[model samples]
Target chain A: MTDTILSHDDLTARVSRIFQRAGLSPLQSDAVARTIAAGERDACKSHGIYRIDGCLRTIKAGMVTLDAVPELAPEDGAIVRVAAHGGFSNAAFELGAPELARRAKELGMAALVINDCTHFAALWPEIEALTAHDLAAMAMCPSYSSVAPTGGNEALMGTNPFAFGWPRENTDPYVFDFATSVAARGEIELHRRAGTPLPEGWAVDADGNPTSDPEAALNGAMLPFGGHKGSAIATMIELLAGVMIGDLNSREALDRLGNFTLLPAHGELILAFDPARFSAGREGNAMARAETLFDAITGQGARLPSQRRFAARKRAMAHGITLSAEEIAHLDRLEERGLDAVA
Target chain B: MTDTILSHDDLTARVSRIFQRAGLSPLQSDAVARTIAAGERDACKSHGIYRIDGCLRTIKAGMVTLDAVPELAPEDGAIVRVAAHGGFSNAAFELGAPELARRAKELGMAALVINDCTHFAALWPEIEALTAHDLAAMAMCPSYSSVAPTGGNEALMGTNPFAFGWPRENTDPYVFDFATSVAARGEIELHRRAGTPLPEGWAVDADGNPTSDPEAALNGAMLPFGGHKGSAIATMIELLAGVMIGDLNSREALDRLGNFTLLPAHGELILAFDPARFSAGREGNAMARAETLFDAITGQGARLPSQRRFAARKRAMAHGITLSAEEIAHLDRLEERGLDAVA
Candidate 1:
């Protein structure tokens, strides 16, 4: 597909319109669109508007309850639960983050768990919500199986993305978002489309044999980043966000959503901690010292976490985000009509 | 130096004796000795009684206050702060874990922040403290710098160990303790002693060139486990434990403990969450579902995290802990005398 440029506004409006046409309430549609737009602005191409069609497919397949309104469970001390009503995670986060932040600020730390949510997008948005409160935050969410455990052949764990945010001193919050795999599935898909070879150990073929062929990898399972270490971290996320939170495990999510060709009904675990409450009389100086760490590392030619994304975000704001011609066409078709043109 | 086998009880008794000779209060010394015994029993030699000499050295150097009694700060909702009074983290955790567990059980979640503590042991013990309470726990601590940021030669980040524990159904808790580096510094030291080669990307030479020579790695700095992903996690630990907790950072720890040949005055963070309160009608089903994950993976030949250590612990309990001849000699030397023979 040939590439093209779209202004941030145009791209977001089209994504929102697509959601509106898909029968999402305006509030839900806007929340989803804003999250996707932020992803694009920060240059996360895979998780941005590119995922609109997948959302539509799940909706068309009668998997997600479009009209379901997320609700917060009665709160306990420093713990808030958001029942996603089988809706997308963005809206659930929108419903729960403010109260979570308030609780954290009042009581030093707080946790929010989102259940029955189809979390198809990136996880940064939920944790980033606490940035407004100058709070430190982290979030984890597990998807259906795609990555294999170390020394095993089958895919039994999700990429299990983790996102962390820090309230900085007068700068944008320092954020680090990563999938536990060597690379995200979308990056591998890009390699497949380009007919490019993958690095060794990136994935294994269907027979559990390591392969550099992107096509073979697409047929098989992706490998975790650092062999056993990455798989262990991914498994922890699955247990914490999936099993412990009373949500379906990876295999269960895969079984239910497999035929629908949509995302699993994933679970998310998020925490926000107030630095002022934790620090010993050094209020915001933690962030200042964090800046010192950044300087110490970056001055030596080492890049700091989220540096690339922040730069891309700055550039996109000044200019515009670029999209593939295929992505543009897909969005146009979805916006102009409904699922009819595609399905 | 040669290896030898020592009985578990004998080792623990001797370790306790050394701590006694080092001027630790009996309660504090017993806590520290029991932790070291557990480590040795579980075959975590680096974080076991091997650290005793370093403890005495720092204490003799007046870096750690032997008379320091850990005190609990006034409770804040679900948060409990343990003032270690410049003592050891084991004693701090020993003093705080029970109250922390009480709060977690009462309020659904609890966090304990140990300030002014010299934590120079495996992180598992603190997280394991919450295991008896059937709590999901995580602990993060930053050590003196031995790992460098990606693309940098200088060591600015600690191995930055993070350990997590999940209460399992009818089994020992699922525990995963890992340094964010490709290999921990101790592993490299082992390779050096064995005159073995290292894997690529494990470490860099003093000139920043990646090398397979274990000696070069020992001389230089260890690399993070998964390049950028591990580095980011390490940096997060540095900020969370070192800066936000108002404790000496990795660099500062390194400088102060350099002559003692001990780990830096690291900061620790531990949190315990009560899954019973968060799970919707699942009660203890969280651990059962977690067992399902373990089965799916273990059936496929993937080893569960901490399986090896649990086996080692079991064997040690049955037979005895095997220490090296050098290690035994060192312990005997310390126990029979004091810091005089060693320092």
Candidate 2:
């Protein structure tokens, strides 16, 4: 059968309905639906409609607060905070972003700290939100522990993701969001399912010896990207986003969840910098200067990160987001069954 | 001949005398000397007395301002600005760090922007300055263009150094500073001198084809660490520390200097975060929490980033820094002839 195509709004609405029916508060459902839909719109299928099942499972397990209403903290100096109140991070971020942008403009820079949230979305969406306000932005958070620190034999740090964006004048903003792990745990699971050997340096066995066997890797630990440097960055995220925010670090999150099946409850750190304020009285326009740097990258035939996603987004907005027959049926079932559809 | 040993203070005084004889202002000389001495004390010899001749060479080339006294800009929100007036960045950072710490404590987070400075020192020195104030810190600066973006053939980004530190209660703060490039240009040069092949992925030849020949790699472009992730971060540095701060980017710095011999004139971005303020109203002590994470790392036999450097420092503080006779002779010549000591 031919795939079913839907506009971005249609997908968002459908996803929102699914969550609303699953007993999520309207505030959480709407924000989360936009994030999930954006993932599909950008052809990032792993984070797209695919994540709905995970959300539902978490809700079914009573791991997430179904009626949470994320609240913004009183304006603090250079820090705009949102207490997620045991909900998804999306609504919390949405609640805090405008204030973050405003304070970044007023203070030259400001941080948005989201606490006590079940975080599962990629960071680019949050980064893009701030970049849309014509600001450079950075965000990071720790996932449940899956990756080993470099030189260590066991998993300790999360597959923490770090993301950054710089606003552009007319084109899409420059952006990159990536896991600090050399490869994601999902990728290893995929390899195991396919009965393929894992890549060297991707993992170490249960006893910490280097291994290419997928099964051994699964029983062991994933490695950080770029060896020690990436490990250090992952550790930094745990400190800044987890420990500094007075929330769960990767180990704590994993322990609380008992397994990686559920979305990890953690905190997130996002910083916004108003380019205009930062570049005040400086020689050249910051936005224009950024364009030159982009040109140099593309001129040398190098692709910028997230170009493919942006390209997919452009096409999806123009044509539509297409879902396969199975996916469409899955969405239908989710809409009809709500929490029951998950298990 | 036996190696010469000198206390840290004596070494600093000696280095200061050399810079003074070469006509640097006392303000610039003292700060720069302390940085160099610290490098030696840490056994990070690459940035130690070896850097003196390079400083002299840059001075002889008339690239650095001989007597420029860095001036602090009036307090502006979360940004602490210091105009280095084309002097080396060491004095500028020293002039601005206390204010950066004060602002960070006041605002929870703040940034120090150093502009129009010839930056050659390792960023950890600046990171440590903030950590000394019991604040988590991050610092980045663009060097002259020498490293390529991941997919690009030509060098479009600098071997930009990224450094981070977290404060600890009774020990050295957790610190990690590294170039975003897979390797430093000096490493390739050393390989060339020793007639050794460059490591795979270290660089691409002039035609953008991967090469192992050190000479070809030297003439070509060094790759960024962790491929695209590292490239994106290096680019972020160019944008945030360079364009956003209204200072020379890597390419611009290279173009202005006309060669790589002199230190690149640009800006540095240092962010300071007051953990106490950030974790206020939260459950745990941020500093104590950081120690637990560090303990996990050590418990697993994964060394924290700066342990070796800290160990060297302890030894140097106890027994003084030992310099080979050849290094001692070089210092003597530099002191006697000042800028005339170099070609």
**Taking the tens digit of each residue's C-alpha lDDT, what string does model 2 give over A1-343?**
7799999999999999999999999989999999999999999998999999999999999989988999999988998999999999999999999999999999999999999999999999999999999999999999988888999888889999999999997789999999999999999999999999998899998788899999999889999999899999999999999999899999999999999789999999999999899889989888888899999999999998999999999999999999999999999999999998877
Best by lDDT, which number? 2
Report backbone clashes per prediction.
Answer: 1, 0
Deviation of model 1 at B154, angstroms: 0.9
Reference-based lDDT, residue A320, model 2: 99
State the C-alpha lDDT per candidate. Answer: 0.82, 0.93
- What does DockQ give for each predicted structure? 0.64, 0.90
Q: Write the per-residue lDDT of candidate 2 for residues B1-343, one digit (tens) a residue.
A: 9999999999999999999999999989999999999999999999998899889888889988999999999999999999999999999999999999999999999999999998889999889989999999999999988998988899889999999999998899999999999999999999999999988889999999999999888788999999889998999999999999999999999999888777788999999999999999999888888888889989988999989999999999999999999999999999999988998
Q: Chain A TM-score of model 1 versus the true structure?
A: 0.92
RMSD of each: 2.5, 0.8
Which candidate leads the pack in DockQ? 2
